[model samples]
Target: MGQLVNIAAHSFTAQDLLRMERVLLDALEFRVSNVTAFTALHLLVQGLPGTRPPVAALAVYLLELCLLDYTLLEVPPTHQAAAALLLAMHTHGTAGAQAPRLLRLARVEPAALARAAGRLVRIHRDAARPPTEALGALLAPIVSKYSRPSWCHAALCAPLDAVDPAWCSC
Candidate 1:
């Protein structure tokens, strides 16, 4: 097993290695995880009403944020995806009540989802503030577009500092 693992490590890209590590962690518990949660979110958003543009935008934003912050990679994609959906729902303000149902459909646990969301919320909040020289390059355009109240009426730019700090602890 160790030999095979070493050989695979030499052949995989950084993203592939990280994904494999996540799978190994999940496999130890004998459960499933949303390795393709990004794809799933893309498809899932289309089925919902009046949520496609904003939700999709937020989801993509969250993914990009995760890419910027390697610490977020510790969380599974399913939980991250769920959190993004919840944030998007919050942005829309129309489906906040449906978060549980939406997460259930995505096969994610609420606690895990909340934890992942907290991290993302912090990322979003921090990225929105000034001294954005590092985060601004990637996030500024997104913040500008989503921050607008008229852009699909998404609430993605709402102050995340107001949310519970516990949401970020995994």
Candidate 2:
């Protein structure tokens, strides 16, 4: 799993791989961790270069939104991470060149990334105005956490109604 993460992340440092192995092993022993979407999310954020804090924060916000929807579980974590990064780039108006580069780095097909991103957009819209009070409560923590100055108020940023068409052309 760590090797898969390294491949997706484009990180090949021996020390880093060892550390990831140790962490995974420890988590397995404790029965407290699974290589979930967040794992891929972290690898993308930590391994990629030139990813700004705002982009990272927004990506995190999007992934957290995915956690609220059980349907998103069907999407692979690497795909989810790629989609989140793509959406974040688009939202920040930095997708001009980065989108294609991200596609190459994440090794995800443009159509697949677009589809995953579309789901995130729908999730974002639903989360913006949760249908039920219980759902709202479920969303509150993510919103509040990202709304903080520390997270650059990422949750306050408006979700894109749809993914930019250009991204799907890559």
Candidate 3:
């Protein structure tokens, strides 16, 4: 694990994100002194390391965010399309590239986001997380071009800006 973190830390090209990555990835478990145990527990439900398929990393990332914290997954539908655009290419019909990257990235691990992905299905009823004006700035362009989720018209209209470092590698 040290090797993995070291490699990721050194090669990690982003600058502003170092602090967030360190804090989030290194978040400690409340009950267990053993972070490894907690991670293992996370893997049990989420799958990690040898057990975790690379394909599922994205799905697992999102699902874990949802299961552990729903607020993290609460983005406007348009923003969701924009978020998908950030890291991947979407494949909706006639639409040249409207597929969400999460679908593609997580394609490596289909079942990981079983619920999180499903939740995307019912976006209108649910409120999105506060629009991180900083984050929205970054994703606006990508989302603009893509057809996005069929239901993303309302959510995708936020003004564009540079993507926030805290939200992604971008």
> Judged by lDDT, which candidate is best?
2
- Greater lDDT among 2 and 3 belongs to 2
State residue 36's C-alpha deviation in candidate 3, in Å.
Answer: 21
Tens-place lDDT per residue, model 1, 1-170, is 44665777767566676688789978887655445658767655655655656666766676666667778868877677767777766655645546546755667655676777778878777766645686677677666666575555342556445444333223
Q: Give the 10-residue window scoring lowest on summed lDDT in candidate 3.
A: 86-95
- Best first by TM-score, ranked: 2, 1, 3
Residue 110 in model 2: lDDT:
75
Looking at model 3, residue 95 earns an lDDT score of: 14
Candidate 2 has its poorest 10 consecutive residues by lDDT at 30-39
Query: Taking the tens digit of each residue's C-alpha lDDT, what string does model 3 give over 1-170?
Result: 45655777755445435666666666853242433312433433232133222223322222222332345444333233333232211111111322232334323233323332334332211212335675445444433433244323333332222323332311
Q: Which 10 successive residues of model 1 have the least lDDT summed? A: 161-170
lDDT values of the candidates? 0.65, 0.82, 0.33
Q: Compute each candidate's TM-score over C-alphas.
A: 0.60, 0.75, 0.22
Candidate 1 residues lying further than 4 Å off, grouped into runs, are 1-34, 46-52, 130-132, 137-156, 162-170
